[model samples]
Target: MSGLIGKKIGMTSIYSAEGTVAKQIPCTLIQAGPCVVTQVKTTKNDGYEAIQVGFDDKKEKNTPKPLQGHFNKANTTPKRKLVEFQFNKDVELGQEITVGDVFEEGDFVDVVGTSKGKGFQGVVKRHGFHGVGGATHGQHNRQRHPGSIGAASYPARVFKGLKMAGRTGNKRVKIQNLRIVKIYPEQNLILVSGSVPGAKNSYVIIEK
Candidate 1:
């Protein structure tokens, strides 16, 4: 399936044409496509079939020399986000792919993005730990603590892949099968129902 690189433009409510009171829908607005193809990979040469698409305008001063050269080859300006997506059909380099080419209203699509970063967290917030026993039971400092980490006189060490708190969020996340509420081709916008990963203006991939 093919996908488009887009920027999340926050969210807003979408009203129904029927003027029904219960038909108001909340959706996240995304600025999608009009992406330019930068590279095309083949099975014989690259051992795969995929097209690299670039989105969002980036200044040459901010882009590295090598990447600038890459954009030069595409005959387009620098892009802020570049992502490779494999398609069933073949696509040529420097081809322009827009949102209308792949998606339409009421289509189900998956959105992939980087979730917001949350530094150093506890088990309660990270792992959904129910805080030791309860709010009472004389919990004190052990209320939000992760209890019984290891066997006492046995292994004497915490097991690997334990749900201990360290870092939270700031990871690649994909939300699947989100319904496409609307598409504004003239404005290069797509409205998806429900919240997507990452903050406003963050890059996201919308895939079929």
Candidate 2:
């Protein structure tokens, strides 16, 4: 499937006409593409068929010497993000792929991005654990604590993959089957139904 590198431009609510009813749809806006094709791989050479595209501009001085040569070979400026996608159509080096050329309204796409970091979180927020102690009877300290992890005698230590209070978010997450509500070619913006992972302006991979 073909994909594009895009940035999350926050979210907003839009009204959609469903037959006679006007429904308020919550969607996330994304600025997709105008991506440049940096490299093309073939089965005979790279043992796979894919195209490497780059999105967003990067300062020339900040780019490494090797990457500078790579961009030079494509005859395009350095990019901040480069991703490979299995493309079915014929693609050439330095070809510009915009949002209009890739997707249209009512199309279902998958968005992959890094989730927002929540730092150190408790079980109530992280694992959705109920309070260990009740609100009454002066039991106020263990409200948000993660009751008991495991057996004390049999299992001496905490087992692996146990849900506990720790670091949260800031992980690669993929939201699948998101319908494209609208597309603005001139502005290079696309609105997808529902929320997407990551913070504002963070890079996301939108795949069809």
Question: Candidate 2 lDDT, tens digit per residue, 1-208?
Answer: 3889999999999998899999999999999998999999999999999999999999999999999999999999999999999898898999999999899899999999999999999999998888687877876788998887878787688889988989999999999999999999999999999999999999999999
Q: Count backbone clashes in candidate 2.
A: 0
Please report the candidate that would top lDDT against the real structure. 2
For model 2, the local distance difference test gives: 0.94
Per-residue lDDT over 17-118 for candidate 1, one digit per residue giving the tens place of the 0 to 100 score: 665555777899999989999998888999988889999898899999999999999999999888999787767778899899889899999999999999
Quote the positional error of residue 167 for candidate 1 in Å.
0.6
Report the Cα lDDT for candidate 1: 0.90
TM-score for each predicted model, relative to the true structure:
0.91, 0.96
Give each model's whole-structure lDDT.
Answer: 0.90, 0.94
Report clash pairs, candidate 2.
Answer: none
